[model samples]
Target: MTLLVGVDIGNSTTEACLAECGPDGPRYLGGALTSTSGVKGTADNVPGVVKVVQEALSAAGRDQHELAAVLVNEATPVISGLAMETITETVITESTMIGHNPDTPAGAGLGTGTTVAFAELGACAPGERVICVAGAGVDFEDAAAGIAAARDRGVEVTGAVVQADDANLIVNRLPTPIPVVDEVTLVEKVPLGMPAAVEVAEPGRTVRTLSNSYGIATLFDLDPDQTRLVAPVARALVGNRSAVVVRTPSGDVADRRIPAGTLTLIGEHARLPVGVDAGAEEIMATLRRVTPLADATGEAGTHVGGMLATVRDAMAETLSDTGGEQDAAIQDVLAVDTFVPQRVTGALAGEFALENAVALAAMVRTSRAPMEALAGQLRSALDVDVHVGGVEADMAVLGALTTPGTRRPLAVLDLGGGSTDAALATGDGEVHSVHLAGAGDLVTKLIDSELGLDNRDVAEDIKKNPLAKAESFFHVRMEDGTARFFDEPLPAEAFARVVVLGEGGMRPVPTRHPLEKVRRVRRSAKHKVFVVNALRALERVAPGGNLREIGFVVVLGGSALDFEIPDMIAEAVAAAGVVCGTGNVRGSEGPRNAVATGLVDEHAGRTR
Candidate 1:
């Protein structure tokens, strides 16, 4: 009996399978998995490969000296990098608006008047409509008293903007209620003596008047051009509970489309350039027009250009380290339309506007020379006969076939960290495969960008785990609206917060978004990356670009073990009348170690 170990080096992980190849056949013994040390298909992965092989051998109760050879999958190094370019920007020329949602604002309704400081209210003429602006140094009681005194003198105090968080206290003391927005961090920046409008809505409601362009036009009696200029200001205040729009002589707001540059798609037949400002749908459509894409490049001196260059340079560095050619080409690109909350410029109070952005994920394809170098390094380090195995997709399909009740005419979807690969196998022994960019890592980035989480680890946790709302100390409401009870009281910080049900424990999401909103963003991001790529990949590999031609799809890889990814892909592909589910290699390992097991199986067959 000859004992051998097969290792599969993936973008995110390394896995090994051990088996005994005798005269009769191969007997599967054990498997092991660990995080890949460095980039897959590079010399840096030698330590990870050696560790996993030793682990697999130990699990099988075999000595390293007893192993005959170590086979590794022909890993194609795929490096994926993503960049977000904002197409739409909201710019306030001269501090035109204070559109931010404070936790608490007082009263409801619109108040328009001339802006004046609280100390100057006493000097106002009777019937002179003015909005009181209270600085942080001013006491809330004194401010309220001053407003009441000014009102008694018929100095109409139509509205109030306070620097401190005392809007509620001031409004409660007023005999006549008026809109009051508080917590204006940059209250000193409010243009005094200018016409301003303050609108505060009731609890659980959004401001209406200031959020409407026509309403702002009517309040300031602006001309058509001025009204057009103020449209972006209204858009920035759409979802705020309270807002203040101050009109200065030179104040203006603009919604501008930034020049994000263009991408050049180099296909087998033609090279076409698509503008990034045209949005993701248009770019993707243009990309499809150039079928069999050979490579892609970006226009010089632009955001997209810088992004693509960064990706290429990083890949080139990795290849150069492995003694391969330094020139790297982008093999695939995935563009997604998303919204990022960017801070509005020239704002009195810090305000964020949802700007239109295009997120591009570029994948670089390298030659097999890197993997060959890695295999050589592994052989010398482990002192074992290490040989590069078959193509990853073919080996994955072979291992997937070991699933119970699976047979010929099968397909496999390998959803890895960096890319999504699809392979279709026919009964006649013909196999077709395609690799596409954008998978788990891209999805995590999308979630982080879209939700403005800015923390990849948190976004990844949200992606891998379900969410819940800590409704009470003893109970929590899950993402599916089911209540889960606990014997112990939950942490105080988790109360009334959206938390991720991670394996470690309930980790509270740091954002202020509600449970449902977070859930929607997470699911939408996954659908955009995984579901879209799944369909795109399947169509590419399916006969005649028709999914119905494929008999069955077996999902394999680390992402396949996700709590929801498999189901999402299955539901997405089911419309084509296909059978799709996660694979169980050898009816034991679930959605993992497929390539490694396939290598051993193929090796055993060759020896036989």
Candidate 2:
């Protein structure tokens, strides 16, 4: 009998299942688990996968050389980024009270100017210039001190747009009768030395109001009608705080340019994306991709106002070098609005593709075709038999699950690490299958983000086993909504960390409360959402509208074995009026061995 090893390398971990083909079918043997040896969506996968197989071999008291065939399941990473766009359709002429976070503030408005430190200009500088000095390189305590120093140097500290958070404390030190605006986080949006009026008005008002718009006209002598001309300019301020209408001593007014998102951008790649040199239309195009200038105070990478210092420096350099052209370019760039929480994974795909047994691997950009990249990666990595047995990933997994099939018209949902893949099998063969973004990694990411725990291990703990906070000494809360009562108060320190699970219900949850709670909730929620969504997606692709007509669904993959995911999915399927449950691909041993057994079974069933 020849030995067959089936290896599945998922995003978070790797697994190997060994089997021996005999007259009676395939006999399962050893298995092992390890952290993913390399990148999920690349060729460098063999070594890591091979290592797990070797462990399986040794555990079965066998040797690698005895292995006749090795079947490796395909692994591809699912990368996702959040995209948000706040398109302001309706513009009210008078309601200038638009507010957002430091990472999100945008829109037009007006204020007066005055020379004051962040600590003194609270209420008085409402209609004046405000300077902010509470960022990383600046001192919060010494803002007043710096103002004094600037006065000594004969530099006028004219105005300030204070960070929204620091407004209450910092606006107390203004020497002049300045009006301090509290909510504007990008206080630096207010340009220094340009002591003039700030006005954010609208189109709807200029015609209707023969009278006034308090916020903008309060500081400047602009009639409501004139303010309408500047409505477009005001609307553009949705992202930045610096740009507003200015009335010079000559009574002539123009929209002045202010700097925002000038954060220093630090990227892994040495070269700028798309183009190298400036002044080219390509750069202009790149600027347009930046966003409509909603909030002028943030940067364009990592997150809102990312690399603030860098964006500022670049904007300054671009302006100084090309002045008007640069300003025009900034507006073009501002047209490309950015959503919140910028997501980026470093440039590891290239190195990741250089793996053993990897005949092909493709690295595609966000704007490119993903399947082409998959095809490319496939050809580069698995040079041998890239198309043999219709070597597609999800389809093959279904084939593996159905080799022992009592029926056709069956669907298999393989919930793997990087992405959730589903395949429907018909009597003729594998018919429909699809790959969707988001999976274990996404769950882990949510855990990491929500828990604020930089520790992935802790996050993983939260995902696998939920943690419950012991509300008091005798009572503890579990992830599933059940509460356990205890005799006394648990340790205060462990109040918020992940807790441990035990026989009596909740053993001391390993993680603290809150974090533990967040992780557990996120993990459970993702499982429910993904499983239900996957089923719904599959049903849409079903031959007919009726899911009840479909016979069987085999849930395979690591996630299928999660504590409650399988049951939850079963209930969902039952609700859909169909029978569903975890795959008994390997009977008592769990969902293991299905792929390898099917691989060998295909040979035996055909021969028999």
Candidate 3:
């Protein structure tokens, strides 16, 4: 019995497939997968590759000496990350605009009054209509009773701002109804003795008065110049259910802008300059026009320019160290249109506004020096004949062919962590492939920015799993609006939240967004990354650059295992009459162990 091991080094995982090869043919034995130790194609990946091989050998109940040969895939290395530079920002010069949502705000009308702290309400002389500010130390019950007492003493309490989540609690106890804005973490900082406007709309409605610039001007009797300056403040608060605007001294705060800088696309005799503010569509369109990109650069003394230069320099340095003859050059860049939620600088309440921005990932065409070095290292360590196999894309296509019901004139979408790769295998043994930046990691970055999770792991969890809302101790509402009951009560932390259903069970999501909102964001992110990339990739590899020419597609890689991604892409490309589904590599390995199995298959032919 001759045993052969095939190892595949992927961007996110390293897999090993063990098989028994004889005169009859090769039979699949077992497989094991582990997280890749480092960047693919690098020597740093040797340890992880070895561990997976050992695991496969153990699973198959075989010893090291029983292996006849070792085969490894020629892995392509890709570097990916998220970068942002806001070209133009809308800034509120004065401390104004509270655009956040509290679970339950109170009242229905807008109220304008002088700002006064809760403690000072008792000392009011008379008839001073005020918006009471309740800070951390003030109890909601006490604040409500104090407002009623002050109203009885002829001091009209028109509205209230609170630092805690007790807006409904306080409003239910009030004698005369008043607009209330709660969950203002900086309530103590509200400018006292200043004119302020508070607006709380009815349930299922957003504030109209505070969210409009003209309405704000009408209430404050502002001059034309002042109204124009406050326009951004109102625009920032457009979608809030409740809002507060307090007038502070002018010039207290100024908007900040990071020069987005110019992108210099160096092509054959054509150098075009594009701005980061031009948006992703324009940038990609410019790239499409200037094909065969020689090199791209950013303007000097700008955020994007510096970032591009740094990446290029790092790649060049790394390549030089690997004994490469040519300097590393950036071949392409992928840009995604996204927004980052930024907090207002001087606002008394915690307020955030979405800033239009773009995130980018660059791709570099590399040599085989790294993979060659890694193969040499593996050969010495494993004490066997180990060779770097065929081209990465060709191996992927061959492995994809092992899937049942797939044949020639086929397309394969390999959606890995760092890159999305596509290949087409023709009937004449011809293959074509293309690699693009921005894959799973890019989706995580979008979720992190849009939701303000500030944690990549948490964002990744939201991206990879389904969501459910813990409506009660024993009941949870699923994303599909169906309720489920649990025999035991849920943990306190999971109650009243949209939780992610991860491998560890129900974990609470740390955002105030409802289940539907978070679900929409998650699916939208996937659509933007996976579904869009699937079509884009298919177009590139299809005959005559037309998707309709491609007959079938097999998705492979870690992302292919995602519960919804495969189905989503399949449904999306169904219009093109393409049969798309996750690959069952070797008719048994599922979506994984494809490249590994292909490595052995390629080796068996050589032996014959």
Q: How well is each residue in 427-508 modelled by candidate 2, as lDDT tens digits?
A: 7775676554345554554554444455766555656665666566556677567987766667675554457564343434
Query: Which scores higher on lDDT, 1 or 2?
Result: 1
Taking the tens digit of each residue's C-alpha lDDT, what string does model 1 give over 139-220? 8889889999999999999999999999999998999889999999999989899999999999999998999999999999
TM-score of candidate 3 against the unseen true structure: 0.91
For model 1 the TM-score comes to: 0.97
Q: Which candidate ranks first by TM-score, i.e. highest?
A: 1
Model 2: lDDT equals 0.45
Worst 10 residues of 2 by lDDT: 351-360
- Where model 1 places Cα greater than 4 Å from the true spot, the runs are none
- The positional error of residue 139 in candidate 2, measured at the CA in angstroms, is 22
Error of 1 at 461 (Å): 0.7
List lDDT for all candidates, in order: 0.89, 0.45, 0.82
Order of candidate numbers by lDDT, starting with the best: 1, 3, 2
When 1 and 3 are scored with TM-score, the better candidate is 1
Checking candidate 1 for backbone clashes, the offending pairs are none
- Show model 3 residue runs off by greater than 4 Å: 87-90, 116-129, 134-157, 162-175, 249-258, 309-326, 482-484
